[model samples]
Target: MNSNQKKLVKSTVPVLQTNGTDLTKHFYSRMFKHHPELKNLFNMSNQASGKQQHALAGAVLAYAEHIENPEVLINVLKSIGNKHVSLNISPEQYDIVGHHLISSIKEVLGEAASDDLIEAWTEAYNELAQIMISIEAELYQSNLKKEGGWKGWRTFIISEITEESSEVKSFYLKPKDQASIADYLPGQYLSVKLFIPALGHEQARQYSLSSAFNPEYYRISVKKESNGNVPEGVVSNMLHHKKTGDEIWVSAPSGVFHAGVESNQPLVLISGGIGITPLLSMLETNKKRLQENTTVWLHSCRNEKVHAFKDNVDRLNQDSEWLTTHVFYETLSQNGNDSVKEGRINLAELRDEVLIDDAKYYICGPEVFIKVQYDSLIKLGVAQEDILYEEFGPQLLHFN
Candidate 1:
């Protein structure tokens, strides 16, 4: 970037850091007023909670912070690019977003927003937008070049359904044309889009691939959330309403949460409730690869009745001497049978039960669960570089 661009980026950082929320609220309000159609494009719930708006503002500010050395922001850019691709956010939309963003900044900063400041922000936005567009284009090309990957949406027909639990069902998806699906690394996710009549247009959400990568089909286990207030996960709820042979739109696989098979160190997989889906894929993939090493799988669920894939884990443990599985049940049934543990997975109990030193840890679950596990891992002197995580929501902004 030129010195002028660098100056612009540096100047805006403080403004964004201080007034980002207000700027985002103003930006969204203005954008929606002009383009009411885009209201459906964003997560209204996230907007109401102020998470999505704050996340976007934080991202823009972070991007500006590294404008002089754009290479440092590659991973951040890639993550957002994947999300945008899933949301089907078009390049044209960037122009719309940029205009409102600049206008909001000017309106918020008032006297501080001089002619030079406006020019600098415009230049910075253009530069960042160019970077995003180029990166997204590369992602599009890579997916298309893959054996079974394609651009835009493709039809996947539900081949079968297996009951994982009373509330969870696993759907096996195969291309309607019987074409092979892209082979993804364990822990990757697929973006599924649904056309909701009430909401209009299409809404997309990412679900982790629960089964190991196979040419025949992909599997996703979804738990039905019937909470009276908040709406259930859009795509998941839609999938639940469909029957065998129903078709849905799915994007090619993408994510960076997979285990690093290249490393020879012991692997530790930690999960709670439905978070077990991705971890199971990793374990299954390792089993298929015949990777014999000390691997620990720690899973926590409310009770045995709701735990999915117990049989699969049991079979893997019996077959592989290197695999050890631990199950923590939060609610034990009546009678002191100890058949199910009666409380949340105690980090102290976990540390006492399992040895984690010299192992790479992968954690996934709700924000609070992940936070507890993460703090415990750090307390145990685990290196930050050795621990990785995948959040179900937009909580990446808080990470380093």
Candidate 2:
């Protein structure tokens, strides 16, 4: 874009900071109204909860503020590109989104929206969209290059369903074509699409691959969301009701949360509640890879009733001496509760034992859980680059 176009995008930063969500909300409203088929590609639950809008708003504001040097936003844009590729979003769809977004800006800004400003934004949006399209194309090619992987969605059969806890179940997915499956990083996830009958359209959700990568199958442990009214747990509930041999559309595994296996530093996997999914994969994969990294798992849950994968962790530890497990039960108020401690997982108190020199920390769980642990670790003198966490939903998890 030219200097004038860049200036036009920069000038909109203030308005975006103030009314970005409103603009994205209007964009989605108009997009879905005109193209109802697009609903199948979005998580309606997130749409209803306003998380999708808020996330898009943050993204827009960031892009506008950094319009002068969009190259600096490559990392953030790549993450979004990963999601878009997982959903099999096509390049042609960008034009539709751009139209609705430009129209939304005009409708929201009213008389202030001049022809020149609109023209500038049109060029600006196209530039970003092209960058995104290129990123997604590269991602698709990367996945396709892996044996047993392809672009877009593939049908997978639920071969086995194992009950892990009162609220969570493990679904073993295998490609219906009976072909080998590509290996994913321990902390990666795959998008699973299911049809929501009540909504009269399909919905997709990303679930962490709970086990180590293998050729036979990919495992995703899902916690049935039991709270709230209709549509709250719609997709998960539908998944839980599905019997063995049922088929679901699945995207190739994609995520940037996993750690590098080459690092010989100590590995710490901390989790709360059902957020243990991806962390579990990390722990399991470390064993399969036979890495020399000394690993520690610090987990907190309400009680043993909701604790998943306790046996798997125990068996893995028994087979080898590479892993250590620590548990904290929230409801335990007395001794002999078969837990290491009570209340939430405390890095400060356990630092002496669980904390290792030159260790990288991986955390996953609720938003607040991640924040508390992140803040605590930082206060304990851990380097910011050594700690990483993944949020479980469509919401943007940011720390600044």
Candidate 3:
């Protein structure tokens, strides 16, 4: 974009900061009204909860904030691209979104949206959309080129379901056609699209693959999110009701949040609550490598009943001297295991295990859990580059 166009976009940063969520909420309502069929591609639960709106608002604000150097937003855009690829977002749909977004800006701004102002935003959105489309195109191609890979969705049968915890269940899915499934990194996630009879439209949710990669099947551990802390999870409840031999639509595994298998650095895996799903997969994969340096896992949950994979981690801990673990429960855990501690995680308490030389830290959990860990690490002098995280659900994917 030209200097004038860039200035126009940047000038809207203040407006975006204050009214971004409302703008995106308006955009969604307008878009859905014009094209109801697109409803199948979004998570209506997030729509209802306003998480999706908040996320888009944040994205737009970030774009305008960094309009002068859009490349700096590449990481954020790549994260969104991963989600877009999972949903089979098409290039043609960008035009539809662009039209609605520009229209929303015009309609909401009223007299403030002069012809020049509209032209500038139009250019800015076009530029941003091109970058997004390119990123998604590369992601689609990567998935397509993988062994046993295909674009869009495929039918998978629920071969097995086991309750991992009081609130969490594991579902082992095998291709109904008996075809090979694409191999994925241990921390990657796959999208599950299912028909919600109540909504009268299909809804999709991304669940982290809970086990190490296997050619025969893919597994996802889902937590029933009915705790009233967040929006009630419609898909999680429906998934819990599933039976063996049930079929659901699943897309190829996609995500940017994965452990670097090529790295030999000592690994630190931290999780809170249901965030353990992907980290558990990472833990399992790390166990197989048997790296020379010790591996540490720190997990926090409300209590033993809701603590998933407790035994599995314990077994791995017992079997490998290279592995160490720490568990924290808000409520007392009567398992009488030395690994269990009462209270939330404190990095200061376990400094020796986590502050290893050149250790790579991978964290997954709620926003607060991640931010606390990140801040703790920084205070303890750990480099920011070494701390990586995967935010759950449709929210700001980046940590401040």
Candidate 4:
């Protein structure tokens, strides 16, 4: 904020740009060394894969790039806030992160990290921390304002578990209190926290609300990760282990990936694999509301066996004349023919088959998939404002 801080930020940009990955690697190693307990706070597999480390470095560099104007970082801050909320990252953890972050910077920069530089980074970290804390606090407050919302986590008894596919299962959850739950907007997500004895404390994950918001209950479809890494998505595997009447902790619904129910424009929802959860909710809600003019749903999966909610999607399509649904399976069945296609969804297919000229597009999927779709949409002449996307990681969908 001050002249010295501004200078430091500007100088740090080059260093960050050049050695961002190295700095992040060192940062985490040092952090874990000092506070081994905090290791559980991060995804170890993500660290091993270098995705989380690179993401953190990229975020730090981006913050520095926009240090002179904090407003430019609003989208980044919001995304981080959502992720933190999903992780159940506490305000207290921010202090721990900040302390280690500064130390890491100094350790990496060595003599070049002067007193003024340290002070500047410290101030910047404090500023970023304050912004995140305030945003998360607001999110928490909003969740609590809703009727079924509660602070921290609340016990939700699993009423039923239906296997949607070999890898995916849908869990029907109801608050143990028996009171009416707050209705969430279609495409929103709920943060589920799990207390793993092996991992210690609690770990959290976010899953999109797969069913239309009803006062009675909520539904989430989770696909078990078979790679056997990252603690198996703590919350998701926990749900898999649950059965009828099992109690689980769930936070209030929160997310910005909801549909524009108020808009009259055409809506195109594109998804891949487990990403169908949110889009399914939007489609179901639209069918119920009869707001189905010019709506298109495109989903991609590997095969019929792993494709979830097929029956529900088929039923919705058969029942709602206003909605059009398309499923693309990469692998062919015994009939030796694929339903729609036999490969990944690309811009060519999207532009040719899915996207409408004047439609508002909502895309959710893996990071690479979303990026490709986004670039294709733009290349196809769709305005930036017309495309909405949500990534699981801390990346800004819209920078401008």
Q: Which lDDT tens digits does candidate 3 get at residues 40-132?
A: 998877888899899999989989989999999888789889999999999899999999999999998899998998999999999989999
Q: Write the per-residue lDDT of candidate 4 for residues 362-394, one digit (tens) a residue.
A: 898888778877888788788998888877644
lDDT of each structure?
A: 0.80, 0.88, 0.89, 0.80
Candidate 1 residue-wise lDDT, 94-140, digit = tens = 99999998998889889998888888888888888988888888878
lDDT of model 4, residue 267: 79
RMSD of each: 2.5, 1.7, 1.7, 2.3
Candidate 2 lDDT tens digits, 124-185: 99999999999999999999999887888899999999999989999999999998888788
Candidate 1: misplaced stretches above 4 Å? 1-8, 227-232, 261-263, 335-340, 352-358
Clashes of each: 0, 0, 0, 0
lDDT of 2 at 139: 95
In model 4, state the lDDT of residue 391: 77
Residue 372 displacement (Å), model 1: 1.7
- List candidate 3 stretches off by more than 4 Å: 227-231, 290-293, 333-336
Q: Which ten residues in a row have the lowest lDDT in candidate 2?
A: 332-341
- Residue 6, model 4, lDDT: 82
Q: Could you tell me the lDDT of residue 19 within candidate 3?
A: 93
Q: Candidate 3 has what TM-score?
A: 0.97
- Scored by TM-score, the top model is 3
What is the lDDT, from 0 to 100, of the residue 105 in candidate 4?
89
Which 10-residue span in candidate 1 carries the lowest summed lDDT? Answer: 226-235
